[model samples]
Target: MHILVTNDDGPPSNQSSPYVHSFVRSLQAAGHTVSVVLPHIQRSWIGKAHIIGKTLIPSYFRPGTLHKDDGVASHHPFEDGKEEWVLIDGTPASCVQIGLWHLFQDRGPVDVVVSGPNYGRNTTALFSLSSGTIGGALEAAVCGKKAIALSYAFESREHDPEIIAAASQVSQKLIEKLTQDWPEDVHLYSINVPLRNNVAEAKILYTNVLQNRWTTGSSFEEAEVEEEVDPAEQEKEIREGERNGTNGADESSVARRKQKRFKWAPKFTDVHESVRAAGPGNDGWAVKEGIVSVTPLKANFCHVPNIKGEIKLSSKTSISGDQILASSSMPKLYAIIDYPDPYVQPLILSAIRSELKDLDVELISSVQQLPSPASPLLQYRDYESVDFEHALDQPRSSLLCAYVVRKALIRKHYLSNTISTWLVKHPQSPLKTHFKAAVNFELDYAEFLDEALVDAWDLNDSMTRNEARGNDNGNKEWWILKPGMGDGGNGIRLFSSMEQLQSIFEEWERDEENSGGEQEEEKEEKEKVHSPSSGNKVPTSASYGGTMTSQLRHFIAQPYIDPPLLLPSRENRKFHVRVYCLAVGALKVYVYKEMLALFAAKAYQLPSHLEVDLSCHLTNTCLQDGPSREGSVARYWDLEDTAHGPDWKEKVFEQICEATAAVFEAAAREQMVHFQTLPNAFEVFGIDFLVDSFLRAWLLEINAYPDFKQTGQQLQDPLIGGLFRQVMKVAVRPFFDKEAEDNDSQGSSEMRLVRDIDMGRR
Candidate 1:
């Protein structure tokens, strides 16, 4: 392997610095080519920093030269050797940068950059925070190279050649092992070897940097110096003396005899105590036990949550944004696409691949082989886990979806209807104009109310029984019954009388007691009744009536709109508008403008009795049995173009957006626990709205994890694909790409922002 070596402790010497030369030789002996670059002077305790604006001149140092007074001869006093090391008049981090990119062009690319074999041990956070040895390695990591920071711990400040040789060999072995089998997502490693005669035989342990802070006192003290020394004053004096052909030493001595000074006199008692109290897995404790400590690290700051998981802090995988941008190979990002919907799965996967195409990110689809801390693009149905949760839940899979939508929209109709009622009660609520009147009750309880009592109950904002009876044409009121926590048009019934409503529940109980084979026949029998030509046989029971024992308890009953707006171009079929909305991060709501109009299978007709066919009353395409209903789904924009007035659809769309914002706001305000707005989570909802002949849109209901497959192949590309792509840009990209922070794309042009409630104060 090709290696570049650097250190905070400059070139090797008998004192101040040693071991670097021996370590380099050891690596060469192990059949690895090595190049060296280092600071011209000691640069300890300075973190990862470049000296901004300075001219760094390179000087050569010969190995094994003897030290002389007068700051060692200008020609140097170090080792005498054929090999030459490059010395930089800058900090350790600067050397790594210059060494990797500018130097070693003829030697080919440097595979790994090794920093240190530092003079003192860098074990805990206290020392590591300000260590230039680790800083050099950090710089190399940010530049997209494998790096290791090596330090030698000594019992005392004395030289031991035998111990140094043993330590060097140990470090070489560890370095080779790590280079061959480095752990995933680890940016760099910090290794500390105890300098002892038997160091080569010591056990190497994986450890964590001890999280410690200085607690006793300040690490500086006032020293009684002869005078104050100013760097600018000294520099000027040196230049003036140089022109006169004399050194500035005598002139500087005279100026320094003026005032007192302060020196760094650190109080290490607290550090020592903390080390002693540390656990065995800590880097400091491992070194104290005469073992080598290797702490793998990421290039980002450590984030501490109020609660921790089963995994240790050291074991979690992390990657820095710098590494992501600088890396040559594609970054591997794993996504779990576990949804079984045929129409939605392939389209979403394709969209994700397309959105991240420019970044050269590899998408991993196998859930079983994922690396720790996988990407946040999980598109699964009703799946959530703490393992996949992020600061912002995006790409759908691990999203805590029930928090803001599913519970408020589908779980209990009573809760949703009550929330809608609360929204209308506010004088300024848009729902007052767009929301439909509805009531919720348990199916068992509703079975007990008589026809007279049902009519006496407050159903429509205290409208008189005669007024609630019908419209000006005197048609009796019709109601649609929906099972609480039910979806996909299951156990839904349309009724015009209390007798018909009570009989629907009775049919469900009979279906539940029948055999599985008998239930199938009964289901087919029910489907046959949906056709208008099939006489007055009520198709009151769905297949769900037999299996919905748990969810059959609660139900919502809403007075059905009699004359739903029918388009002449649409063959006068009854249809409902399906709009997609997104809720992000503590209450920011947006509506996707490209909506879908789902048409019922048959032509529209006002219902007057229990003999009503759901094919005429329900617009869900899922209920339509045959492939003959190819035109069931159409773009809302196309419908808008065909409307009588050019602005009619646009005006209705405004009402839809307004009503959507109002419903979400009321849900979050009233049912905070069930509809929590988490900063790290977002969800897409399918909201259905009904339109009257007057072109007024009314909020009907909300559906969480809406059926994207219902959009069908014809509209999936522009509707579903665009939605997933925009979601990736708005939600997932910012975590891995920094450029996404400045350009949000405003969640793309299709999504319209309606409500924003900042939860930042919490």
Candidate 2:
């Protein structure tokens, strides 16, 4: 195997340590072609830094000759005429980076990269990440190669011959196992072993890096004792130095006595008993107890809440941003095409056409589409763990691609409505009632009578009858029932009486039972009646995007916006305007200039009876865009299709755009904070709005995943295709840039694709 061996402790000749030369010699004896590259000088705790402004020249330098004062006589002290030494005047990370790409470019891909026999132990979360020894190995892993960060733990800061032999022997055996068959899930292994004389057997322990946030303590101190020297010789030496005018070394004066001396240095804490109590195992504790510690690592970081099955943690300790950025110089980008939707096809093509052309968009059609399963709906909360520097480093099985795919979630509605309410509620927000069109309270079961809109008690003569019976109004009322999370108007019921609502409530009880949520009394209730089918026989009960079972636990009820302005062509047919809101990141929200106009199938009126029928209300395209009465489906209209003409369209559109813009700002403030990590996600919201007769647009609900297909004859726009083309430039490519990121500040946009909807971020 072509093995590349490197370390932070320069080389065997310059370093006082014997581990680097000894390990390389052992690998050569084991019948492997070992190549050597290391920092020109000792770069112990340099972390993962690379020269930013200057290019690195991987110059071949005679090892010990570079630092003559280290007392080594020859550069090739351990040379048996089988090894080559290459040096780069940079961090250990840069050594591995240049070694793989430049020095060994012609020798084919490296089989494995082994970094360090680092002079000191690299244990615990903070030190392991900060150690340059591990940084070099991590760089190799970032380059899609298996790597091990090896360290030697000694009782004192001394590398004895006995300790050197033990470290080399143990490390070579582990290297062989890694080359033959590595751990399936981990790409990088940080192996820290105890360096001791061979007196007994020492067991290898699997451990997790202990966690702690250490605040480095520092101060300067003065020496209290007086210096003693040869009196006559010191006087003569001082006189000679005074004659030469070089008395910088004199320490007898009061000013010299006051000179500052370092009392303490910055350091990270070890894996102690307190840390051991908190984990499956602790890496520092293993080394402290004379056992070799091996920790497994993975690439994924974000939380997967809506995964189809069990939620599994990818690793014990997630690799932080600095650790990922410290290693690997290559920058690449790949997208996971998790869906085969027609709208998604354009995006893959556009990403290929842009800077992401180097990447082949991975088309995911099944669970096996990727090397591992992907839950596209995962919230990008652990953004801090995603190393943008190594984002293109293809993870073995789990990966979060450039463009994220998410399902319409119930929390979307609550966030959108809650933010709008919150903004309107705050005096400092400067946002007015334009944001007050959604649910007025926090969503918890969306129960009735608690801030209930219109009570179904009005269905009966209950109020009038109670007044006649000399009774005061004190009873709770029913509300317009809608599923917590819904799309295309699947499970919607406008109940006129309390009995119809009671029946729907009983069915919710059954749904909770199936979901394993807290279930209520086992009350049998028939499926609520929906729109009339083509044959107009039994009412269809098919669920649309989400199953009926998932919707029962989460739902929201608002005052049914009644008596909406009608499309005069179909007299009293209530219609609502649907707009699109696109957010590439948190605090970056934009509203598409154009929108769709969808209307209900039947004429609008109050259902005075207890029997429920969805045909009259709920203007969802899936329900209303089917077969029409006059052999024509009616949905999605232009100004020419409506009787109000372009003037009315102009009047209502201003309010629609204004309300949507307000919702975007309010939602950003309320919802985006939860999603701190921005690189893993980009979303376009399907925002629905109702235009009241007052010409004001009321915020309805926000759909997390907007279905981009043409439902009816709305004629999907060509401009919508421009959206995907811009996403590569605006969102994905920026993560790859080496410069610092300020994506949240809202840069200028090409008006063709998206408009500036920045509402002055406070």
Candidate 3:
């Protein structure tokens, strides 16, 4: 596997730098192709700002590769022909872009992007905006790539060989585990190691970002001065100076004279005073108490509602967007396939039809045979005239269906009527309803497709340009592209750019337009080519042509939120609330049950300018010091441990539950309007939210599908089983009994009509 290594800390030098060469060599020793890209100058503290105009200029420097030096024990063994050096003039983020777009252009896709082995620990507040490390990892995540940012924490400036060795060992172990069993859809991981000689004894704790603060207080005062005179020297000096009338010996000498002494008094002011008052249970407190912290992060910042309600048939019904099913009455399932992944339409349709056994489920294809094993219950039906497969294969009607099928699905679900005939007889129906509907599923899909189109074009252009320039670090264009309809981060791509994607979209559009009355069978070939069955390679970069644009219609751009900086005056540090919800006893009961919260903090010196901002920044355990190069100083404050004494913890917990309940309410209402269904079943959503200094809560993204895997081996008796059982009870049960009854009656009527026709013939 090819490995791409990048960092925010410029390039490495011949002189000893623990991070650069050491990290590269380790990966190389593991038999991976390692490429390094870093800033030309330190771009530390500059969060996600891309070059707007003339700011971004390309500069080429020497490459830093493995070198054989006699002094360092970590040096590579002298190999006669191997050259080990590289240099690039770009920010750490730029390095990742270059490696993906240019350096490995011919080599196919890179396996992973690793940032750091940073000099200091990047935990809690520091993790969010630590450009020196986290920035690189974030760039990869945004581009839809699997990435990891690694750092080691030490007690002091002194380098401990044992700690270094231990960190290296852990890195290797983690890489092995992650490479073999990394979860799908997860793009990045932030890992921190404690600087202890006993790596085994040092606990590897998985924790959330702690909201804490460091103190910044100081003062200045005037010094006291005293003057004294020496008798013999003063008399002689005064006699000599008196001839010149320069205030010589005698009276002047006695007054001004002999010796002068000054006393300079310096006082130490506690800049961390405010932070100290924050009490405990923050990331800073944990780190101060000596514990390693690891926090999992997400790229998408949207909420995933447990349930949505919509007015349907004069009754209020709860629904979920994921539960929305497409009508099976349509003969042909229109699908877009760019890569090899065969469209899994058949499987999805099968799943839905299995759940709705009474409904008419038809499988139409231009191809004579079905792609998968035929379902006995879903009767594979044939249509006349139109060869949907052939039409799908043709470029004439491709793009149109990309729009048309989506339009059809939306109309069917919203109006509860099939729009195929309406679209033909009234060709302007789609136009009339275009963008009028508040909730459009196809629109979201289109948004993502458009972004992918742009990214694909940009990637191709950037690669071509980089190849021409022969600059190894100029390829920041390759990206991982994900489809909007895709879930669990599936249907991803390690694509080059927009040029390759335009043809695909154009073909899809053309097909839909030309195949106006074509039969489903004729269009099977075309549909098969673009189906999800064909394995799609994940794209490397999120941006196209270096422009920041959302690939998916409903997608969002994510920024790195630095973990809060924690001061060392407390016990445990870092804590986060994980609220869970369920529909119990038919009343839609949501609960904030379990919390995997912990205390942790980063060790960092605050700049002078950010002091006030730091205090007000609502120091959670997640954010570290902000930019304070001028007079401003970013301070860190802890949350007062009102929880332990006098019911503070319980009170805080109750408030968290209330806030989560509010979020659920908002989400449920929005979902209701969108899905037009009743909230009947139970769903367990892990909502992660952060609280500020004033105890004000800000919501992070909601995880619709939270992972059950534990970070450590600290599971107790019930552990995940209890949560799983609760979720399974709701997920397995059929939520829409009314719809099912309606379908059954309709089926019975059809059967009776057939029987009556037979009897009349007799």
Candidate 4:
């Protein structure tokens, strides 16, 4: 193949333009005829610009006859007879034009144009948009030829010849392959090769340019001039350059510019930091990871598809270039919508569309179905994984690089048992006033159960407490028993006496036995019927799915708060505030201000009988059936209309935030084993809180993957939708997009940051 080679970095020298000579030699050694053309001086960061009115003067360069003082030898006249390279007094793009249409005609129509093997990397949008190396390739591509822009990424200023040679060979192999089967729509390719020892064996991946911006001050600072500089010192510096064989007209001439000049010194430290914080799978990230990157693009600006009208006809339906780029460049989101909350699934997808804007979203169904390499956002629906599985077992590092797993570690038990113990341990804690006293124990263990009963009656602290408390009296403390892992009002019972609590356990045991017997009877009936029909034994699989009472061993009983803050407006119905709190990374907590006030289906009343109607007590919307559930929820802020004072709601919100911060702090400090804060994971918790008649908020149980359906249609968009939007802004977007733009350090305007355990970024 005949190849035309041009570069933004001019002819080879000790400094700026170093690798082109070795690259050309490697191509020649591979038996490809090569013609070289380049700008007389380095013209980097000059994007596809042409010197409009100036005549492009050309000069020739010979391989071995370069003069000692000829750094810009091609700037002057030279014999064109036996010279192999042609240098033009113009831009890199002009070099491609002159080489293709004017100089290289005698070399037989060039099959392809190879630009650079540049001095340094051009990967992200910050560099690619200004890259003259890519500009030259774009020029060639527009002139109807295959083109490739090549760059060598360096860690330091020093260049190693062995690594350069290895990178050249890799480039040659990739170029041949690309040119052999080049796509029709792809005009040019921007290829970046990292300058490292193992570059020969480096994997070449097709990647897209990372769209990043310069947010660290400015690239150019005001050039400072020393008023009292010695003229002799400046003259000496000139002599030193002349003595070193430079004519003071090479790439280093930028330093020799007159006074009051701005230097081309970019704050490279800031760029390096951005690369460190960049998400995986982009061109910049690939080069930083020591892999080769190939980015295909068009020569002209991308054409936007018509989103607001009639469709046009063509040979066939085709995707727009912008859509193609988006499909490949945007991160994938593996989402699962298996949760029972009907509103949550759509709300999550809607939030992703509105907040994230673009992503490759694949709706999956199971945890076992998580794709290879894993999506950036693994939005799982299983609560058990968030509670124990993922928290205990760390995910692979490939999935940990700026990834956001769906599950977070703070579980329901954490709020009850963990916070209760933590408050007891720290007597001076402010949370002691907000959290309720609870006794946690395994229902299957008799000793622990007895101990919990004793703790419930305060038998260990005061034996005469039960005797002083009358039987079934309103003065006696009522206890609400809940399964540790249960949600949606499952396995919960209200009891006042020790006999009532024990009978509740007995009832659960009897129900479990009846369920087991039913399953056995069904299994036997199936076997007996299939034994004659198939004449084969039917397989009996061990039953794993069971009622929550039979499956979960742990349970907690907390003192039921009477005289719940009842609103006069709906006939004084009992209600609880469902505050949405977001936990991100390891870890930062934010409380969503648009809370939901979930009201009980019936009016508030103290239990007069042991068999109590829970609808009068429990405010969980799931406990209400049909049409009643729809009217059971209202915006918590709306309660301000009926609130006793104007600032009463605000004070309750502040107290809620304070209690939330303390709860998470206690979890992180005390229950690190149960609540392992993974940097790649985040979760939104539905934390319940009950307020007394005095407006003092009491902490209730926490629920992960909260039921957004309970928020109802009226407040779904404002509460749940806004909650997810802020969640993405706080937890999901920062890891994958531009940090300066996407990293919401303040979370959102409404989601207040309550707790931040600054582990320092990993």
Best by lDDT: 1
TM-score of each: 0.51, 0.40, 0.30, 0.49
Taken over the whole model, the C-alpha lDDT of each candidate is: 0.67, 0.51, 0.38, 0.66
Predicted candidate 1 versus true structure: per-residue lDDT over 1-762, tens digit per residue: 568999998887645567688898676544345788899987877879899889998887756632311122234423322256789999999999999998766555787899998887888887788889999999999999999999998765456777887788778767766776676677888889998767867878788878888786555544447456664454344333322323334422222344656544444555567788877787888888888888888876242222211111111111111112223565445454445454555445445555655444333344445444334344334445323334233433243333433476546484556566576567678877786556766545334545324543655333344345654324566677777766666567886655566677666666666737865766644543343223322375433344444345677777777688898788888889999988866767888989999998888877644356677777877666554365788998898444547888888899998888877877777666567677556677888998888888977778877888777644656678778666666655543455774565355568787887765522
lDDT of 2 by residue, 213-308 (tens): 443222122333454444344434432332232331333324354544332223222234334455445777777677777766542211112211
Ranking by lDDT: 1, 4, 2, 3
Better of 2 and 3 by lDDT: 2
**Model 4 misplaced stretches (Cα beyond 4 Å):** 1-342, 358-414, 445-472, 512-550, 640-643, 741-743
Angstrom error at residue 734, model 1:
3.3
Off by over 4 Å in 1: 1-333, 358-360, 364-405, 412-415, 445-456, 460-473, 513-551, 640-644
Worst 10 residues of 1 by lDDT: 312-321
lDDT of 4 by residue, 1-762 (tens): 568999997888646677888887666544355789999877877989999899989876755522122433544434212235788989999999988888756446788899998888888887788889999999999999999999988665456778888888778767866776687878898889988889887877777777777765545433436534443443333333322322212232233344664434344444556667888767888888888988888887331122112111112111111111225675655544444443465455445555665655554555466555333434435554332343234342111212232212234454566766786788777688897776666666332456655545442333245436755466766777777776676556677665666666665455345665666556534432222121111111112122334457777777778888888886688999999888877778899999888888778777643356666777876655544554577888888444567888898999999998888878777776666666666677888899988889998877666666655444655677778778767776665554533457467669898888975544
lDDT by residue (1-762, candidate 3, tens digit) is: 456777655555322235556666555433344556556555544544455453444443433433322321112322221223333455667677777786555434777788876655565553345345777878887887878777665544445555665566556445544554566655576666666766534544445544433222111212224544444454334323322223332221222443544222111112123224444433333444455444455654111122112111101110111222234552222222111111121222223323433332232333344343222111112223233344334322221111111111222223212222333444553222211111112222233555433443434455466456442332333332333332322222232334433433343344444544436434433333222222221122211211112233322211112232232343323334444444221123344344544232322222121111122221222222222111111111223444234544455455655544443332333333432212222234455444433443334334433433321112211233333333322222222223333333222211110100111100
Candidate 4, 487: how far from true, in Å? 1.5
Arrange candidates by TM-score, descending.
1, 4, 2, 3
Give the Cα error of residue 393 in candidate 1, in Å: 12
